[model samples]
Target: MRIIPREEWGARHGDGRYWTTLPASEVWLHHSVTVAPDTVPPWTDDFEAIRTIERIGAQRFGSVYGFPYTFGITPAGLIFEGHHIAKTGAHTYGHNTIGRAICLVGNYETDEPTELQLDAVAWLLRHGQAQGWWREARLDGGHRDLTATACPGRHAYAAIPRINARATQPIGGGGASPSTGGAQRRYLQEESTMQLQPGKHGQYRSIPDGATRVIVGCPHGQMSARIIWHGPGYPSTHDMDTRWPDFDWVAKDAVHNTIHRLRPWRVPIPEKATGFALYWDYPPVEGHYDDYTGEVSFEF
Candidate 1:
């Protein structure tokens, strides 16, 4: 594996602080969510971008948690060392000690990552596992697998299965097997009956298995909805705000209620997901709070 060490990027070592030894059992993938400059070439290695990310990490989290992640991957598939394996990273909240974080440098929600970037991540995982750096590693997932925000977006997250497959197969050889025994596409829909009282959170309905995509719609009220997935070791939740294109406004009234409309949102299901929880939040409106009651639908 070709890697740019800390010294190569002029990064300084920590102040002799180290994380407690724990078996590295997982690899958590992340996206920087930073916009790249259009002037740069597509496959060119951007060392300056890496430095800027590290500087941002040092400024934002250095005092309390040191650097944020163990490594960063450039758009050209170049890998840069971050906090090193000796120190615990501040990447994944509950599983930091047990997982290694490798962040790809781009916002995947708006753009797709290059093939080289995907291959580099697979190569790193395979190499790390062989060296026993990830002695107990078996599963790999996105940063959102353990958090509330969308650190790794849909495009990047979709590549997780491919990356996992490449990690086990011979380099530059066979690819992942395609799904067989095609099951009929299914959709599960649910509507919210309980009102979302002001200044309170609503209970989440459990998401059934074999669900590939989920579409949630608030039929009558304006509220922020969340799709929380509960995995084996990590649980991630994402709010449906304006960031997602699918989270759009839908007009149903003929002419009476032009200003108020139902908001519909969609999100992809994470792999190895056992179940999911769906909930909504009602923020204050015009300095006053009101109860929101609506129905939600899911497409599996």
Candidate 2:
């Protein structure tokens, strides 16, 4: 694990900062509000993403002379080491924290992250886990869990589970054993601090116009798994207030009543999306499941 000076990162803003010589754990997941292409020119590769972060951090935090703890950039699966962890960074909620800040290039709305970019993130997280920087005990979360804004767009965050799944799976080496369950166990998504109405049995709600849906498979009882979603209306602005909300009431016979557990869910508000959104909600008590929902406010 080589550390680089922020000054060498290229774009000004935050420099002279330091980062960890190696990661602490295995759970590496990330997001970026604005992502540019690696081949677009301004800087060298997608690493310019980190430098751009420095510029933005400097302007927002009013610190032109300091460097944040750590910064990272991704376009596909390629991870670039930009700064030393010793210098606290101004990125992600704060410059200094337990997790390393990684940003990917591209506006998710207009562009989908390439397999390479996603693979890069998985590698980093796996690397961290191998180093004991992150672990399976901790549930990987999204940027929205910390702040009020949606810095890492839906398209980007939506892919977290897939990325995590990839990282945990063994490729060249031996794959995760059956006992470990490999990548299938770890799933992550960005949650908006805001809260919303809880699901109930036989009740009907409607998803507003535009919404993103993310689905993940959670631990299910013997021989069964389930899916959850925003059956009615958009996700409200209410926070669950706790790590896990109190399980609410719903009919066992709901459309998909078996679906429980709030996995990250995002679905675009398109005519087709509207159909997709309600598909999970039809027939009261059928599509009921506990899952996190949020509104997408970022533009492409």
Q: Pick the candidate with the highest TM-score.
A: 1
Model 2 per-residue lDDT tens digits across residues 123-174: 5555555655555422265565567756456776788777767766653332
Residue 64, model 1, lDDT? 41
lDDT of 1 by residue, 96-213 (tens): 7777888888898778877666767777776676666786323478988887878788888888887777667665333211111112213322121123343335354444555565
State which candidate has the highest lDDT: 1
Candidate 2: deviation at residue 300, Å?
Answer: 34
Which TM-score value belongs to model 1?
0.52
lDDT of 1 at 280: 57
